[model samples]
Target: MSASSAKVRTITRIAMFAAVLAVCSQIAIPLPSGVPVTLQTFAVGLVGYALGAKRGPLAVLVWCAVGLVGAPVFSNFMGGPAVLFGKTGGFIYGFLPMALLCGLAAEKELPGRIFLSAAGLLLCHLCGVLQFSLLTGMDLLKSALLVSLPYLVKDLISMALAERFAAALRRIPAFAHTKC
Candidate 1:
């Protein structure tokens, strides 16, 4: 492919992932606990790992912007400025930096390793929990115990599974240009 065509193809792929992320956000499985663990984050982490630093965060930015526009593109089909300002707002906004940080870690020479990806996801969880507590007036420790800890195993498994899935996707003709 020509250089410009390759670039366009790459952008198209990133946009596709962003759309997927938005859709994933809408499919929420409400937990008994106040925190609903959505598969959207799994897509966020996967985008970071699969698209590398630059395109990955760009994809997330697109997803977030779409969600902010009252698109019902978030967990529980929630969106709009109110959603951004709501108790879980921080976690929603936090996804940007989290995805970027994880993407950077997943793209860096040493940082892009699987271990770093895992660690980056852990940090994302921490940031989300802390922000969640601050927004909800809950204790940080309590937030961690209630919201973050329970999701640890699941997130780890999801990240690992995403890594594997991304690897396989990269081998496909259509997704060949995606960086995994």
Candidate 2:
């Protein structure tokens, strides 16, 4: 393909991943703390793995932009600036860095990718718990125990699934040629 065509294809793929992230965010389970467990992180990690460092965060940015603009694309069908700045907003904003970290790590070999993705997930949780605690006047340790701990296993599973999906995607000619 020509250079321009290749760029177009890459942009198209980024948009596709952003849409997928939005769709995955809809699969949310509400928690008593007003936070929701959504498949967003799974899609975020998958986008990073599939799109690499350059495009991954851009895709996440696109998703965030959509939600910020009242698209109802966030967890539990929430959206707009209110949701972005709400108690759970940290996790929403954290997705950007998470994608970057995961994509950068994904540039490495399999074991490295998994390890880095987990680290990225940890960062997301940290941001999430910190914000949750601050907004709710809860202690940090309590926030971690109540909000973050319960989701660790689930997020790990999502990370693993993302890795698997990325591996499969890597075999496709369109993705195989792209470099991180």
Candidate 3:
């Protein structure tokens, strides 16, 4: 394929991942703790594995930028700086680094991918808990127990599923040009 063709393909894939994150944000299951369960973690892991370090986080940035600009692309169709600066903002903020971490792991085998992805998830949770505590004036550990623990369990499974799906996606002809 020509270099331009590859560039276009890469841009298209990044755009698609951004859309995927937006759509995933809409698939939220609200919890009593005010943080909803969404497919975003799964999508984040998929973006990392499929696009690798450079491109994965780029896609996440695109999604974040759109959301911050008043697009109704966040959880519950919320958007704008209000959502970004809200109590759960740190979790959203953390997605960038999480994708980066996951992308770095994409160069490795499945076991390595899982390990790195787990570490990335931990970072994401840490951000969320920290923000939650700061915004709510709650203890960090209490915030984690109240919000992070439940979601962590679900996100762990989602990320593993994302890894498997990315592996399968890599084999498809359509994704032939996507970075590992």
| Predicted model with the maximum TM-score | 3
The C-alpha TM-scores of every prediction are 0.87, 0.94, 0.95
Number of colliding residue pairs in each model: 1, 0, 0
Model 2 off-target regions past 4 Å? none
**Which residues of candidate 3, in runs, are more than 4 Å off?**
none
For model 1, residues 1-180, the per-residue Cα lDDT tens digits are 798998888879778999889877877778876568888668988888778777888898887788788888878888788877776676666666667666776666773466667766777777778777888788989888888898888887877777777767768877775454
Candidate numbers sorted by TM-score from highest down: 3, 2, 1
Write down the lDDT of every candidate, Cα atoms only: 0.76, 0.87, 0.89
Error of 1 at 14 (Å): 1.8
Clashing pairs in 3: none
The true-versus-predicted C-alpha distance at residue 108 of model 1, in Å, is 5.3
Residue-wise C-alpha lDDT for candidate 3, range 66-115, written one tens digit per residue: 99999998999999998888888899888988999889898766655667
Clashes of 2: 0
Model 3 misses residue 144 by how many Å? 0.5
Candidate 2 TM-score, true structure as reference: 0.94
Superposition TM-score, candidate 3 onto the true structure: 0.95
Clashing pairs in 2: none
